[model samples]
Target: MIAKFLRDPFGLEDAFPPLKKWQLWLAALELEPPIFKTDVLSTVNDMAGMSGKDKETVRIMIEDAQEYSREDSRIDLLAAAMGIPPNQMDDLWKWAAQIEPI
Candidate 1:
């Protein structure tokens, strides 16, 4: 489920093949405002417990996802894939807001 959800918009599974549980949790976590409060950097830093090189790759993936989310149809696609309510996608954006540059 999560694999397909992330495939197109984020290509996450590809970026981290044999995707671990934490990666999926990170996806879900990115949608939750209160939990992931800061931005993609925090998400990468907090959840990506990987080497510096791997972390950079994950960061690039996240940056790409954020850029992709700008299109409404893409947002709907992602929201549906992630089981997020269409109406609440704005809230998801709130969580994804980049507080500062990495």
Candidate 2:
């Protein structure tokens, strides 16, 4: 662990991977007002200004993603639904990566 830390003092290597879906949700729920899963679902449902099929695809991605990548097209809508900008989603990803799942 010490060697790994010395190799990458800022954890940039570890932080680059996609963040697990659950981690992001966990963080969101821990927020002051608490962003419920329903909040994200409803917001995504309302904001996707596209065909039903497209919306469904996006919804599926959100519901089933194991890890969220910054390059994913759907991520823009996902982040926006959470009131987070696409570019800023990296911050979410970095923070989420640090969450230790139980």
The prediction achieving the highest TM-score against the true structure is: 2
lDDT of 2 by residue, 33-63 (tens): 6777787878767764678787788788878
Worst 10 residues of 2 by lDDT: 85-94
Candidate 1 residue 34 C-alpha distance from true site, Å: 12
Clashes by residue pair, model 1: none
What is the TM-score (0 to 1) of candidate 1? 0.34
Per-candidate TM-scores read: 0.34, 0.74
Q: After superposing candidate 1, which stretches have Cα over 4 Å from the reference?
A: 1-27, 30-66, 99-102
Instruction: Give a tens-digit lDDT track for model 1, residues 33-83.
Output: 523323435645654446787656655544454344334353454454355
